[model samples]
Target: MSTNERLRRRIPQQDRSRAMVERIIAAGHTVLLENGYEGASTNRIARTAGISPGSVYQYFPDKDAIVAEVVDRWTDALHARISCVFAEALDGPADQLSVRVVMGELLDALGENPRLLRVLIEELPRSPDSRLAAFERRMDDLLTVWLRFHLRGHDAPPVGAIAWMLVRTVENVAISYVLDRPPVERDIVADELTAMVTAYLRDISLP
Candidate 1:
C-alpha cells in the first residue's frame, strides 16, 4: 500500500471491526451532509457514530481521512450501481437506449446523497493528491474502457476524449441538478444528457 493510503485510515481485520469502521464512515458522511465539510469534525463524527473519540482516532487520523473513506464508499456504490449497465451494454447492442438508461440511473444515485455529493464536488479538486481525486481519475479511465467497448464500431470517436466528456457531463449535471435551486428533475436532466451523448456518438459511429 502507498504511504498515503495507509495514512488515510486503518483496515479492519475482523468482521466486528469492519462493521465499526463502516459505522464510523457512515456517520462521518452524515455529518458532512448535515453540517458541511467545515462542520464535520472527528469529535462530532465520533459522537454521531456512537463510538468513543479515541475509537475514531484509532481508525482515522483526521477529518480528511474520514472524508476520503466516505468518498471511496460513494464511488464504490456508484460502481456497483452501474456494473449491470456496463455488462448489458457490452453484451449486446450498446446503443442510445442503453446509454439513456445508464445515465438516468447514475443521476438517481446522486440524488440519494445530494448534500454530500455537493461537498465532494466542491472540495475535492483543491487537493490533487487526495484519495477522492484518485478515485475520480480512475473513474475516467474505467469510463474510457467502457466507451471503447460500448461504442466499438467503424469511425468511433476517440473513446478517451468522449469518456472524459461524458464524465464531465455527469459532474456538471450532478452539481447543477443536485445543488441548484429547485433542482431540475432527474429525468429531465438525464434525458437531455442521454440525447447529447447519443447524438455525439451516433454522428461518429457507423450505423
Candidate 2:
C-alpha cells in the first residue's frame, strides 16, 4: 500500500481534515527547506505529508495558497516575538545600547529557524502575489504601532515610515545571512544593524 493509503487508514475520518491541513503545512516547511521553492511540488508535499494529492487539495486550493498561509503564520510569530523583545527592554534607558540589547535578543529568537526565514524572504517574492504584500504591510503596521507607543515622549521620525524601513532592513539582513556564499555571523550583523538604526532614530527622536 502507498504512504497516502496508509496515512488515510491510520487517521480517523473525523480527524483527517485538521490533521491533513497541519500535515500539509509541516510538509511544506520540510519540502521548502529541502528542495527550495521552485522544486517543491504539490505531489512531493503530499507525499511528505503522507496524504493523497486529493487530500491536499481539500485543504489548500493550490501550492501558492499553502505557501502563503505558511508565510503568514511565520510573519505573525516573528512580529509577536519582536513585540515581546521590545516589551522586555522598552522601559530600560532609551539609548543605542538598549536598542542593541533588544534587537540582538530578537535576532537570536529568529535564528532558531533559518530555513523558514530563507523561504519567506526569497520565495514569497517569486510567488508574485498581492496577499504577500498585504501580509508584509500588516506586520509593519503592528511594529509601527509599537514604536509610536514606546517613543511617545520622544520626537521621533514618522512612525509608519520608520517601522517600514526597520522591517525591510531586517528582512534584507536576514536574507543575506541565510543565503550568503558563506553564512555571515548573525550576531555581528544584528549588532551592526541595531547600532546603525539606533543612531539614525536618535537623530530624529532627540528630546
Candidate 3:
C-alpha cells in the first residue's frame, strides 16, 4: 500500500479530535525515539500520550501507522526548512558562499534530533515512495534547474546527472556527519563540502 493509505485512519473531523490525533502523534514520536521501532508499541505510545490504548486505536489502526505519522511530520518539517534555504540560495549567485549556506542549514536541520534521525535512517524500512526518497528527488529537481540556468553559457554535463550526484553526495555526507559524530567540527565539514561542490561545478561548466 502507499504511505498515505497505510497512514490513513478514521480522519478526525472535529477540532478536539484533531488535537487528540496530534497528541498521539507527538507521543508516538517520543516513544519511537526512546524505545526504537521494535520496542515501541501501541500501549507504550498510549501511556506516553497519557491516553488509553483504545483511544490511540481510534485515530491509528496500528503502531506502524502511528510511527508513519510521526516520521511524516518530522520529514515534513525538515523539508520545509531545507526548501526555504534552497529557495533563498537560488536568488543569489551559485557561489561557494551559497553552497556553504545550504550545507550549513542541512547540517543544522539533520542535527536537530540525532536520535530520531538515527531511528529514521537505521531502524525504519525504506521504500521508493518513502519521504526521504521523495525529498531527495525534489532536491534533485531543484538543483537540476539551478544548474541548468547558471551554466547556460558554459559546456557542462547533463544537469540531471550532476544534480543526481550532488544531491546524494551532499545528503549522505551530512547524514554521516550527524549520525557518526565525527571529531571534526561542523564548520570545517561545511567548508570542505562547499569547496568541493563549488569546484566540481566550476570544472564541469568550463568551456
Best by TM-score: 3
Error of 2 at 39 (Å): 1.5
| Model 3 TM-score relative to the real fold | 0.95
Candidate 2 per-residue C-alpha lDDT over 31-97 given as tens digits, one digit per residue, 9 for 90 to 100: 8889877888889999998879998877666676666667768767766776666755565555777
Residue-by-residue lDDT tens digits, candidate 1, 76-157 = 7776676666556645554678877878777777778777778877755457665445655765777677667766656666
Which candidate do you rate higher for TM-score, 2 or 3? 3
Candidate 2 lowest-lDDT run of ten: 3-12
The candidate scoring highest on lDDT is 3
Off by over 4 Å in 3: 1-4
Ranking by lDDT: 3, 1, 2
* Model 1 TM: 0.77
Cα lDDT listed for each candidate: 0.75, 0.70, 0.92
Give TM per candidate: 0.77, 0.70, 0.95
Clashes of each: 0, 0, 0
lDDT of 3 at 172: 95
